[model samples]
Target: MGTRLRLTAVATAVSAVVLVAASVLVLALFQRQVTDNADDLATSRAEDLAALAAAGRLPDLLTDIGDDSVGQVIGPDGSVLAASASLGAAPAVTDRLGSEDPVRIDLDGVPDDDETEDYRAWLVTAQGPDGPVTAVVGTSREAIREDVLALGLALLVAMPLVLLAAAALLWFLLGRTLRPVEDAHLRQRTFVADAAHELQSPLASYRTQLEVAQRQDDPAGWRAVVSDLLAETDRMERLVRDLLFLARQDSSASAMSLVDLDDVVLEEVARVRPTTAVDVDVTGVSAAPVRGNRDDLARLVRNLLANAVRHASARVQVACRQDATGSLLVVEDDGPGVDPGLRDAVFERFRRGDPARGHAAGTGLGLSIVRAVADRHGGTVRVADGGGGARFEVRLPRV
Candidate 1:
């Protein structure tokens, strides 16, 4: 399955399990709570009856208990004295237990198996001057069963709806979260197709030019032309590399593991030193580790360095540092600083400063690639204010 489907399935399964467990817990607790309520009502009635009989006001006292509990009264010797109408015909009250304490028993009138009768009753006692009077409250067991069954049905009906709502929320969030990835993918595909078509014309022209230069046999002129063609080829190679990196990042196939950013910066600085004409400076050296794809990190550093060298007239400074927020990578070029208004525009793919004045051959994808890599690493890249030059800063979380 695709990643989205797998993630959705996992989320749905976990939600279902949790919802089912919660529903079961609520149902069980509700049933127990209701049962307790019934028992408490029965006990309260038994208490009121004991008080009435103790004061010699026993006549019809059982009827008053009828409101919340089925009531029947037994004489001091355990013979029936009164019974609630709802109970219809019950057994002798003396046949039940005594004391203010309550007990559950089967009722007399309802038929059970061929040999016995069926109905349920609570047997409780009332205190008397000489002995204890019994109060029996008979109720249908079906009452408790009906309440519990209703609760179970409610949960069963609600659970599926809850699960669907949760799944829908997650699905929407996933779409929003993956929007950037999808956009990058589409942009890359378009870039590849356009790049191929654009490169074909230049390559064909260079081939034709080389053939004509060869025929001339003029060493100086031919060498200059060959140099220009080689430069174009290098620009094409850089563009291809950037496109590949972006594709890998969007696919999330790039290796993301823990590495020391300080070390990577040092290595890149060393690599750039031999080719760069301007002086290089490294500062804030520390073991700043972060989780990232090492090769992408190297590419990001290389592009930033190349951009600095291409534009800097006097100095290029590279620094690595860590702070509370994250690891910071700063590259500054002591050349003509970028115009304040154009800093944002410079990062766009194929955009360059003063294109009319001609720039060293470049595919103009460096900054775009840098931003893509930073995003993959869950970091950011932005312009930093430099006193008399342009500065680009990259920030990533330190592990």
Candidate 2:
């Protein structure tokens, strides 16, 4: 069965066992309390009757006894002298009698009753007008039985409902707890598949070029094949490097320190200026300090600059400044802006925008890496309209 079902079943079974044990314990205690209370009441009544009999003040009918109880004062000859109204004209409730200590007996019913009702009787002996006599008192057991039966029925009805509720709550909490894990597992699978697909292209091209170079007898033709092989090798190397960087991002525990965000931005811009004809504007740059791994932050800045330079029509603008919330960095390119539908998807690994936006030379992982670095630094990145082209913004917390 599924994990949630298994967990719920185990938890419910434990609850059922505990409930059963607790119910049995409570029932046993209740039965004992009820039985003890009845015995004490019967004993007290018998003692009072025995005192009256000793004083030679016994009457023909006993008084002050409960309606469900029976009392009898028996003579030495076993003849009933005084009896409670419930047992009118009946013989002694019990023949056993003791003088030093009270005798207790369980009987079906009194002599005159037709129905077999349960009773607890206490017998005590005392001196009477003629000689020694006995005082017997019996209390009905129906009330105690009724009380116990009511409690048992209540628990029988409530236990299932309680278990059902507990199971439902447990299932809901387990689902909530496992959702993120399931999502991460799905993402990992997708990432592996995409990485394999991306690598297969370069590998196939490299093998084809090697085979072609093996057959080429002309030195110039061999040179052409070697160049093609080198280009494919370079492509594969870049893809591998990007993949390794992403893998490390998942498990890296890099230390953090105070770094100037604007300085990183300026350095990346200066490095890229020599490689591209796109104009790199640094006029908007300002000192923006943040606390994070300096190398990762530089990578973030580098990726953003490279993406802009790769797509920009002629000029690329870079800006960095401290804001009320934290540090804000923006990069805008004047090339065809990202399609509105693919803006969010661009940050996803291996995701590329429309071909019209010139993604031919890009690895598609640069934007993904930019997002990963921003996220690792407890920041956010988003794409917006840069007036004429796409604007990428990165926000990080201030030191």
Candidate 3:
């Protein structure tokens, strides 16, 4: 199972165990409390009955004890003198050991079918007309059993529902908590596959070129081979650099300082203007200060430029402006812009606009890096809408 599910299961199990233990403890205490109260009441009433027998008024007070009670007054010879209506003329409930303090004992009568009875008795020796008599006060345990049974029933019925509700809540919460982890896992898988694909072509080309050069053994041929090797190495190095940059971003933050968007854009424009046939426009550019790492902001501009330089048919516009909201950097190309449907997909890692026409020997991570920098700086990057060509825009908050 996944980490989230395992954690939730453990939590649920612990909660259930604790809850069950607490319920058992509560039920046991309830039983003890009820039984203790019953014993106390029975012993007190037995004392009253013994007092009446000693005063020679036992008969008058005999009916005073409730019918639910079973009482008997016995002479020292173990013969009954008086008894409650519930146990009329019954023999002594227990052998009254000559003790002043009350003694408790269990009393069972003839079993009725398979059902048993709830009987608990208390015996005490008190002063009587016949030297000394024993008073037995026995009570049914039905009240205590009923109360305990009700609690047991409640626990049995409610525990499952409580656990089910807790499980359902945990399922939802764990899903929400692990959603980002799942996304990152999928992203890592995709990244590894795409990185391997990008590196494979360069390694294979290097191998084939080296083999070709070895067969010829010509000085001129080896030079050309070395040159090609260098270009391929450069390409691989750039890809590795981009990948490392992204990895580092996940681990820590870069130093931040105020930066001018115009300066960064102008520098990137100057660096690329000579390499492309596309006509570049910088008339719309302006200075807009913001807080960010200069290197990352510069890379963001370079990637946008590289993207435009590779795809634009004739013209690419680099524009910058500042507003109440933030600073905006807009790059527009005069080629067939990104398909509106694929606009969002274009910024994803390892995504390509056109493998045949626009890959441009450049890594597919260029736009992804643009978006990452924008995000790291608490900014946003998006495709601007203007109908004809692709318009990419980056918005960064001011310092």
Candidate 4:
């Protein structure tokens, strides 16, 4: 069975057992209480009759003896003396009489008109004007049985409905709870497939280059082939490193501390200047302190700078400063700007910017990493108009 169905079944089964036990207990307690009430009534009636008989004031016909009950006064010779109107000249109710002051009995086939019924009877003896007499009082068990039966029927009908409701509620809640798990599973599968595809190209190129190099004997040709191999190796290493970093970010929380955002920006700009001809302008840089993992913040700055530098036609503007709400960092490049439509898509893993704007040189994960770091630090990153080029903005809460 499916997870939802299995869980629902288990939960419903437990509820069913509990409900059945509770219903049975309720019925038992209710039956006992009603039976006790009936017995008490019978005892009370019998005592009243005995008191009357001992005083020699007993009536020929017993009256006001309560509902669904009968009373009889029997002589020592087993002869009926006085009886409830319902008994109507019947013989003695029972021949089994004990010498005890009072006794209770569960009797079946007690005369009720032409038919017989069950009763709970209480018998007591008292001295009359002439001799000792027995007073018997009993309440029918039929009403008690009918009441218990009705309750049992009600529970029998309601239990399934309640169980069905509980099961349906569990099914709905479980589906909602597992939705995120299902989505994460889907994302993991997609990520693995994409990673494999990304790694395949460089591996194939590296193998083909190795095959070509094996056929060459000239040292110069071999040196050139070695350069190509080194470049491919560097490409693969960068891809692997990026992939591992992303995976780590997914599974772990980074250590955080107060970091200087402008310092990171300037350091990355300085690093890029020595490698690229693009003019790196940090004239707009200012102090912007924020709390985050220093290494991750540095990576975020590095990726933004790398993306701008890779695409910049001539100049890249870097700026960081403190604002009322938090720190604001902006990087703008004088290159083919990102299409407004592709701005959000650029931050997705393995997603690249417009090819008409610039060559896609990096592993296409730089922007993704930038956004990931920003999010981890409770910040937001977005693309905005940069006059003639693309502008990336990051906002982080102040420490």
Q: What's the CA error at residue 84 for candidate 1, in Å?
A: 35
lDDT of 1 by residue, 1-399 (tens): 255566777899999998888888988898788777777776676666666666667775356654334666776765656666554344444454665457877655554334433345677776678787776665555676788898889888888898889888878787788777777767778777857865786789798888889899888897789788987778678777776666666665677899889899899889999996789888656767889989899989988888888888878988888889889999998888777777877777767654422486567778878898898888999887996888999999867
TM-score per prediction, in order, is: 0.52, 0.83, 0.83, 0.84
* Candidate 3 collision pairs: 337-390
List residue ranges in candidate 4 displaced over 4 A.
Answer: 1-5, 56-68, 75-77, 98-102, 109-116, 126-132, 161-165, 168-191, 212-222
Task: State how far residue 72 of model 4 sits from its true place (Å).
Answer: 3.7
* Candidate 3 lDDT over residue span 85-185, tens digit each: 54556574645555878999876762324665556889877877668877888777775788899999999999989988998899889889898778677
What tens digits encode model 2's per-residue C-alpha lDDT throughout 1-399? 276678778988998999999999998898898889988998998888988987888888887778777788887777777987666665655456546689987766555355657778888888766787888888887867887898889988998898889888878887788666766666677668878999888888877777777776577787788788788778778887887787677656678999998888888888999999889998999989999999999989998888888888898888999979999999998989888888899898877766678756767899999998998999999998777788999999877
Better of 1 and 4 by lDDT: 4
Model 3 lDDT at residue 296: 95
- Model 3: per-residue Cα lDDT at residue 164: 85
In the predicted model 2, the residue pairs found to clash are none
lDDT of 3 at 310: 84
lDDT of 2: 0.83
Q: Judging by TM-score, tell me the better candidate of 1 and 4.
A: 4
Q: Where's the lowest-lDDT run of ten residues in candidate 1?
A: 110-119
Residue 126's lDDT within candidate 3 is 87
